[model samples]
Target: MLRTLLKSVSELSTKIDKLIFLCQRSAMGVIDRRTEEMDSDAIHFPLRTHEELRSLEAALDNKKYRDHFVARLRNLMCDDTRKSAKACLQYILSPELANIYTLHGTRSKFGISKYKFYSTVQSALCSHFRSASCPEKEILHAMATASQAFLHDARNKVHKRGWRSKERLASQALSDVTNIINDTSTST
Candidate 1:
């Protein structure tokens, strides 16, 4: 029990240290585009099968975060002036998200999935990058449900094309699920 607590504390301390270094880089961006190249010695992740990567690629290619938000994140990360959204998008599409290129310094590795990486890093990054924004909490949950329902029913109302933002569509999906549940219960 004590060992687990010690490990957790160690991890937290490492993350805090990384966050400080990232902040230092963020300051430089204000003066220049932060084009300073990050070290190329970043650890690489193992490759997955083509089919596995293709599916993940499709999802990441479909990522719809507001453009300004994405730009700010890239700026704070490293190589702000050099890295492109398409490149970042490609990077995240792979299964190596947790193990891929890390914050500019420190060898700490992340253990979250591609879908979860942003959530874990957001608050810290947001504090430094004022333009950073994520979808609302409820919207994030709804999107998770929608992704699951898409697996169950591609033709479900949640999959219908609409002008709504991704977050709105996700929120609507939750409402749709609730309505269906109520209808079935009342009918029974």
Candidate 2:
């Protein structure tokens, strides 16, 4: 009777383990769907000029723009780097991950470090693409370069537009003061 009870417990344990695994996978699927929705709303790159911004807006309005852009990026990558870079881009652009890093100001949350994140991305890439030639260092470098470029372009655009608007406001105020002075002197 004890041996039969032990066998039943083992089977139950295995079933519970399978249920937990399925739950985790379903949770990940939900997160991925949410991330895709957020990605649809957010622009990943900085627009340097008004024209560029308008162009991007137009492109986004078209539903196929994302696929076209991804295809173009993939075409730019060499064969060995393509799969890894694509996977890295997907991971980097995940809205949930971005929010965690941006809002928390740290990458150590949920016991995840940079290395672990990279490894996860690499493993996913290998499983999905059946290729592992691309190194984690290269993926890191690509992410860094893209992030820096986006920030630099965004800053430059903001500064230029900010100064232009400030100068225009100041000039308007000065003209208003001069007009007031001129009218008072003439009336007096």
Candidate 3:
């Protein structure tokens, strides 16, 4: 019975990790959209002093324009990074996690209780974080990289001493959901 429980936990962890990946990708899409908008909104320089400008333009080349555009592009990128990081921070702070916790009410009746399930999830998520070779690492890295802008503020609040990653919290929620579904399947 415990072996089955562990298997279910493993599968739940995988599915929840996938959901985290989807959310991170959606956040990146937002960043990419901002980058495109910045590119399209580039300012056009007015013709500066016709005669002197002609002589100056011949000597100036595109360097000045290129440098200004690059600076603007970097600013846009920074803005996008900040926005995405804020969204991710909000996600981590949301009270929706309580709803996730409620799914495991029945699991308490079994030996597979909430704390144990949470521990399993925490272990899996930390393992994935430590091993960059994991399939979920790319998604985790994208999330961490985008969230760097907010880390100093969010690092303390996202997780308690028990779990370190959003992935772990999400996985615990999924394990509860899977247990509920399996209970239904057995009943039918």
Per-model TM values vs. the true structure = 0.21, 0.26, 0.20
Model 1, span 1-188: residue lDDT tens: 99999999999999999987566544423212355333212212122233333233222332342233344345545422122222333343332222232332235542222433334234323333343253345334433343333222322223354335456779999999999999999999
List model 3 lDDT by residue over 19-100, tens digit each. 9765653443312344322221222222122332222222223444434433433332322333533343333223222222
lDDT for 109 (candidate 2): 35
Root-mean-square deviation (CA) per prediction: 19.0, 15.1, 24.0
Winning candidate number (lDDT): 2
Most TM-score-accurate candidate: 2
TM-score of candidate 2 on Cα atoms, chains taken together: 0.26
lDDT of each: 0.39, 0.45, 0.39
Q: What is model 2's C-alpha RMSD?
A: 15.1
Clashing pairs in 1: none
Model 3 misplaced regions, further than 4 Å: 1-152, 161-166, 186-188
Give the total clashing residue pairs for model 3.
0
lDDT winner, 1 or 2:
2
Q: What local lDDT score does residue 37 receive in model 1, on the 0 to 100 scale?
A: 32
Using TM-score as the measure, name the better of candidate 2 and candidate 3: 2
Off by over 4 Å in 2: 1-130, 160-188
